[model samples]
Target: MFETMALMPQNFSLPDAIWRLLISTGLLLLAIVILRTLTARFIRRHVTSSELRGRLLMNFRNGFLLLGLLGLALIWGDQIRSLALSIVAIAVAFVVATKELILCVSGAILKSGAGSFNLGDRIQVKDFRGDVIDQTLLATTVLEVGPGKTSHQRTGRMIVIPNALFLSEPVINESFTDHWDFHVFTVPFKREDDWHTAQKALLAAANRHCKPYLESVRTYMTKVGVSRGLEVPSVDPRVTIQVPVASEIHLTVRLPAKPRQRSYIEQAILSEVFADTDYSTEKP
Candidate 1:
């Protein structure tokens, strides 16, 4: 339909310009369709570094397509004198369509390169922390790894968090500072309970698996903290128990660990308590 608008020269015929505009528009659409499908397929099939690169490329391609469309828009402008204005209008469209994406990509690169969260780290990016499975420019994807694991597991769903969180929001990398964060589970016992004995058994289990790693982590934590002028973070194992609830006392243990290992350690300690605790005593 567009003729004079498609050409730089006024002498161009209406039919010739229309043909050129349609031809260019057709090619643009074809590229868009092909690139969308191919890139989606590649990202789906890959993981880790390779997948990250592919998604990053896909984000760049989106910007490129916006430029291509602007090219066509200019080619079909109503008046040759309005060429600069058409270009400016198209530039705004490019920003509107791609600004957020560009921000996300920028944040993703900063975070990934800084080693913010490695695969399997328990990180809550904008409140979606679990075990990180894959991180890409567009999203930080994780498999929820807790009591919620089984419930969400049936659906085989992965949590996809926008990477822009690295820029604007606080990231709670549970794996970075604490390998483990614990919740207390309490079953009531008599006031005359051997709580110390019960607590020991739980601590013993944790010490067995968690103690050896302490020697190495202690030095690392201390050196890193001191260099950064941070308090030499306590590396010794810790256990806190409280009897705030009637008939039950709650015990909690926390240890430094890799993010991926939190669930396993929790299960281990719980199994130890279930096996060793005596039921006759009632907590008051």
Candidate 2:
């Protein structure tokens, strides 16, 4: 009779403790649910902007859930330390296993915030030059430009580069602020050819071809020079003579062009130079 009476207290206490834990957990969960619902409704009704509403809801939901979890942990305080240690171990293992994935995601975040490049911008990374078509946390998709072709024409190929490359490789954003690039071509002629006439002809051709963009190019270059500390060169077409070989004279023409139109402009200037009879005639 004594033994039975002594054991009854322990048995009753165990059940009482369990019941208290269950009740507390249920109340906490209920409170969390009510809080979530109320906050979500408040956000939806009061927040006008979709972006702001989404941000508020997400923050409130996470905060409320964290508080609920903390309350549950307090109720089961004895197991909290072990649970935390287990979570830390699992997190460390996951990070170690997915280090590359983490780096790629980090790179994506950096890219978005840094404004290194954007969709529809032409960028060159290492040997790959293309227009950005798609971007994700893991990779950036580009419509491939010239590889074997001489021009910056699309090659009809798509390339998916891991976002992690942005962290390690140099990225050249051709369309960063100014979409213009310099296009230069060298025309070879006989040593006895009239160099001055050739230079005049090349300059005229370039000016005629690039006249429409002269004002815009000048404004863009001025802004770039002020911001980036780069020397603002004249937007006017320039010709330089090079005599790399004794037997031939080379006339080089430099003009401002969009990256995609470099080849086209070069071809146009060459056609004009060939058509100029005065420049084409050899001096005896």
The CA lDDT of each predicted structure is 0.68, 0.85
Candidate 2 weakest ten by summed lDDT:
275-284
lDDT (tens digit, per residue) of candidate 2 on 149-182: 3356788999998999988988888764557777
State candidate 2's TM-score: 0.56
lDDT at 176 for candidate 1? 52
Model 1: per-residue lDDT, tens digit, 1-284?
37656766768557876788788778887887787678766766665587687767778688667867786677676545577788999999998999889888998998977878787666665546576888788888887644442211213457888887788887766555553333323334455677677677767777787787877777777777787888876655566777776766666666666544555666767787777567446455
Candidate 1 regions exceeding 4 Å error are: 1-84, 109-115, 148-156, 177-197, 208-213, 242-249, 258-260, 279-284
Query: What TM-score quantifies how close candidate 1 is to the native fold?
Result: 0.52
Q: Give Cα distance to truth, residue 235, candidate 2, Å.
A: 0.9
- Candidate 2 segments exceeding 4 Å error: 1-89, 148-150, 178-181, 185-201, 223-231, 241-252, 274-284
Clashes of 2: 0
